[model samples]
Target: MNIKSVNKLHYLIALIAVFTSIEANAQEEIITVKKDSIIPKKEESKKSEEDRNVMLNAANNTGPREVNIGLPASVGGIMIQENGMPVVHAFWPELPTRTWRQSVSLAKPGLTKLSEVAITQGELGFAVSSETKLGSDTPSYVGNISSSSFGWIKGDVNASGKIAKNLYYTAGIYANYDPQSINFKFTNWADRTQIYRAGLTKKFENGKGKISILYKYSKSASITSHALFRYKLDGKVEEIDGFKIGRDNYMLPNGRFKYLDIKSGEYKWMDAGGRDNESFAHTVDIIGDYKLKNDWNLNYLVRGRYSESVSFNIFPTGMTQATPESGFTVKETGEVYTGSANSMILSYTPRTPLKTFMARAEIKKKTDKHQWRFGLTESLYSVDNFTNNRSFYYQAAEADPRQLVRQGAATGNTDADGFYNYNVGGEHHNGFDNKLAVFGSDTWEISDKFSLSYGLNLRWEKLKGDHYLTPRTPGFTLADGERTKFDHDWFHIGGSISGVYKITPSFGALADFQYTENNGLLTSYSGNVTPNLPKTRSPLMGLGLYYNHPNVSVVTQFSYLTRNNYLTRLNLVNPTNSSQNQVETVYYDIETTGITADIIAKPFKGFQLHYLITYQTPVYKNYNFNAFGNSYTYNNNSVEGISKVLMEIDPSYTYKDFKFWASFRYFSKQYANLTNVLFFAPRWETFGGVNYKINDHFDIGATVVNFLNQRGVRGSISGAELITDPAPYNDRLMVGTFIRPFTVEASINFRF
Candidate 1:
């Protein structure tokens, strides 16, 4: 072997010797204790101390906080960005990508409510699994109802009991409505959300085995929120002259919106917000667990789902103007111009139906010193045809912007129908996608204070579909008549190595490393241009330390991560020429180094404090690309839409039958664009709440969000792509999104 290779091997061996035990084995032992421990002990072990802190966090989850549900808000000191829509990524643009959806979302609704959540692997990015806990031998019923000052209401009820000899059943229903505090008019559907869900499960015993079937139905209306606020050159985000950041939005308050149907070529008005983009789904799961001879076990599951048409509708803010141009005319009145306006894009994706099926099987064997597991998984999904629509219009740049039309010929950009046709075209065709994976893992208990674990996964994925073959830019003359067919398949391998060591009963260390790969989804084909299908390589490494004491506990971790072959499509504006723009496809890489520390302390009875801080630098590398026949470079720039520092402190106190708690979260400034010249300043979000238990079966609570009443802006700059220098646009207005306003929520819980 070469000298460098030998040195690397020696370095790895040294690391393994330093951190001897594997985190995977440590996790397995911890979970076993949580499930099998029958007696409560007064003294705390290192594991018990960690568990206690977890329980404390769960018990204190009473306050109002930002709830995006299925959308990516923040994670690992960064916010996930949605730069393009590809079917293989997420059914919904804002949701987690396909590989992450199963872990991040409870799309099946009842799955989470009826199971015990668990993480079986040291690296969460590798896998997250849950164990179903329905149909307990004992009969039980639970229910809760909540109402908030902002016209939000939510309720759920669940019941489980034995129905027959060796048979049990569970049933539950949940419903909720959110008024969206940041937007105007609670009565309107703009930015509103409503959900209804019901589920039933049956479990029965067979010879030497147990089987369960679960069925769930869910219906939901979730709206997209995008608004306009001013971004200054000095890194200050300010509300427009007549607009309020939290109380105003670009959407119409009456739940009315108009757009031309691409297929019909006729204007139609639909309720704004999620009303025009509702979804319904039905799912069934069959699960089985069998005990085998020789210390072996077998587990299998089959899941099927059918979903009704689901759509996406949003009015994303665009270019802004201090005053309307001369020919600007009100669409409703057909009169002349005058007011300042913000150019807006009305983008719509019509509903498409879907069907999916998944099956998995796993076998496990246990020995005196080792545990081994092998698994196979197969998943298939089919989607119907869909189209993408893009229409443009001007709106008064105020609190509640009103649509305006520029006077032009019917054959020109702006039509007599009152809007400019940016591009309305077919995006996706009916197609099927499939994935198959085989995995294996082993954990070895090496000694009293050390363990080792390793795992490997091989996955085969295929995307078969056709896309509309039309250029997507404005002024393109070709119609959407041609189609591009794609049948692409990829094979990827991933592996993880982790070790944990206990220095003392109350102190421990951990080390982990993982490598994975990803490719574009079927929907990526919709870009008209042939999408890049290169495998994106991602590698992560982490080192951590934990300390535990009766009154205090701390956990700190240092992580380094790198990912290459990131594919994105950007609409770029020339920095040297404001009027010149182009749409380009680019590939880049990102490297992130970070540190996170979590500390919990209970100095006295009934009072506790928990603090968490994360500092990360996620920056672009080798970000050179060509657009409009010109080469550009953006190396060493900060990744857009992510803050470098995040911190939260939560404190709670209990006295008699009342408990009071509060949380404060801080985020550092974040870059607004890829070029990194514009940014939004740091901001804080605060929440506090109190709960009172009136009786064994009754409890009431109230929470206040944004208690400090700080108004701030966040997320990316709406349409300022590739604007390296902000000087020329200083005089012109710019738009972005803002945080929600102060709000309050209350709830009541009951048990029997």
Candidate 2:
């Protein structure tokens, strides 16, 4: 079917489900109550009196009822009653609620009242945000291409409300625009891109049960200048073996002239950057509780969901860069020779579609003091129409000996037989995942001051994939003269156990442990080679201690994990000719440990603080390297991984109708690879913001980010060098060149 047909079908199915649900809900009784004086004595009278007293005691209570208005008024302000009841009136673009319960009445008419619905409540909101840098730096190059400074702008609007007593609807649209320019010193380029998205949701609520439907659509477009490096040789190119092209004297000393030639050229590069991925999903869920005569409440839930995604990629070549002067200058004094254009240049494209479905069921029994829950879930995944393509280019050149005697002669020109001469091939990957799981948790109060809770979960999964390759180039075939096909299936099993114990009124302790095992195969389309990777097993554990008080709370945790053997590629010198060879093999025993701390404090009025810190150590053991026809070993104990530390702090304060907040983050220098001068550099960042309320309907705020313009460098040594010398390997460090040091933005908010 065509793309349009598929989208229509998906929409039809969702619309049908929504209408059916609405019709079913309409059959129920609908009642309307008017505000009147119908008072109940004793219990009811006492509750009302207590609620009023609580509201009177609150310091910031402004409404007739008790509620805290923490959010912006435009976003649907918050309201809390003295009785500890919460009321929300915000239109969240992503999550919308339909019903607005303005008030409650104790008077009962006839018939049973299992639930009530109101239609008068709904909200709509709009917001915009933007950022700009405070500093400038020269653009850095990637693969010899430079990149420009970065910035972005975004805006969104959302609306939600109850369409009927029991039905609600919400929808919103958002957009983003970003433009960037890069200066490669030798060359400069720029790009501009924009994205737009819209989504809708409908929900039905009855008592404690709800069902929801959601749909979203998004698209993006971008334009960019071509970027690449190319050089033209002065020689005759030859069509070598099997469509492969190499210079007739490619490796010969001073082969056909110029050495160290540089050139600059322009071309166009365009792609969706993989963001064109689109998908649709549907879900049906039911959750309710039944009270038995024995005072036991039984809760049951069932849910199912199905989704599919269509994604595509395309890359083409014609796109070429120009060559710079040969030997410092295009010597007009001599005759030069050039080569043929039979060599293949490679390009790639990918396209795929995936679908998945899942279902789960759970049951629970609860009492005033304790609760127990158990559930089982399963999932099915599939991929269809998966395709990938690769293309190659070939070429040769020669010089005119007669022109070499005097002034320069036009450098020999190069040409290609046709774009079709480039070899192209495509591959497809289809995969699926099937999972089954069960879990249970319980919470109990052993005593008035001490409580305990624990949970257990277990899961099993099976993964499988079908891989194949198809050649698209005419008259070009693989060594085996056939397309490659590969298949594999693997399984994993894991479980977790966690518990929390309250040691005192303000302190607690928690612990958790998890373990999993997996086995799979590594397949290669190169000559039908398929290798099995060793089974891998990993186990993880965590322990934490917590402290809580009226003004502050703290939590500390320590975690450790270990993994079994894993396969990786290695490079080694050939035994006969000393050429490099690549191979894959398993390396066993990898472990990591980390310690973390979190703190929250509210020591004063209108003030809050949050802090987090973590330290980690990762270790690898039993290092074994394998190459085609060769194997090497290293002392497992000699490898030392670098240590790391990270910390963040956030603080906020509000005074005299003005609010301010700031955050800071720090990262210590870390060892990135087995190199001495190439450690990961340390970095620090900070941001802050302030807001002022001009009146009930207006407010203004400004925010600044990355105030410290800090740069970091990540380095690594080339594996090829490591295999030969192991030491003296030149470090490849990507240094942070330019950064926006800081960005400041101001926004004005409005409410009605």
Q: Best-fitting candidate, measured by lDDT?
A: 1
Off by over 4 Å in 1: 1-133, 182-187, 190-207, 253-269, 273-275, 315-317, 322-325, 408-413, 424-426, 473-479, 571-583, 626-630, 728-732
Q: Per-residue lDDT for 1-752 in model 2, tens only?
A: 11111111211111111000011001011111111111211001122210111111011001121111111011111211111111111111100111111111111211100000000000000101011000112211111111112333434334444555555544444443333222212111111222221222223243444444333333333222111112112111122232211101111111121111001111212133333322233433333344544544443334333333322222211211123322111233322323221122222222233444555455566677776655565556555533322222212212111111111214222122112222223333455556566666566656664444444445565656655343333323333234334444444444444455667756666665555555542112211134344556656566777777768766777766665554332222233331122223344465556677766688898888867676665445676655455555543322221335767687888898798887776656543333222333465556677879898766777766555644222212122213333222232111111222345555555433
Among all candidates shown, the one with the greatest TM-score:
1
Query: TM-score for model 2?
Result: 0.54
Worst 10 residues of 2 by lDDT: 112-121
Model 1 TM-score (2 dp)? 0.81
Which lDDT value does model 2 have at 146?
15
Locate the minimum summed-lDDT window of 10 residues in model 1. 23-32
Candidate 2: list runs displaced more than 4 Å: 1-151, 180-208, 219-349, 385-428, 448-452, 468-493, 517-535, 565-589, 627-643, 674-677, 692-701, 714-741, 745-752
lDDT against the true structure, per candidate, is 0.55, 0.33
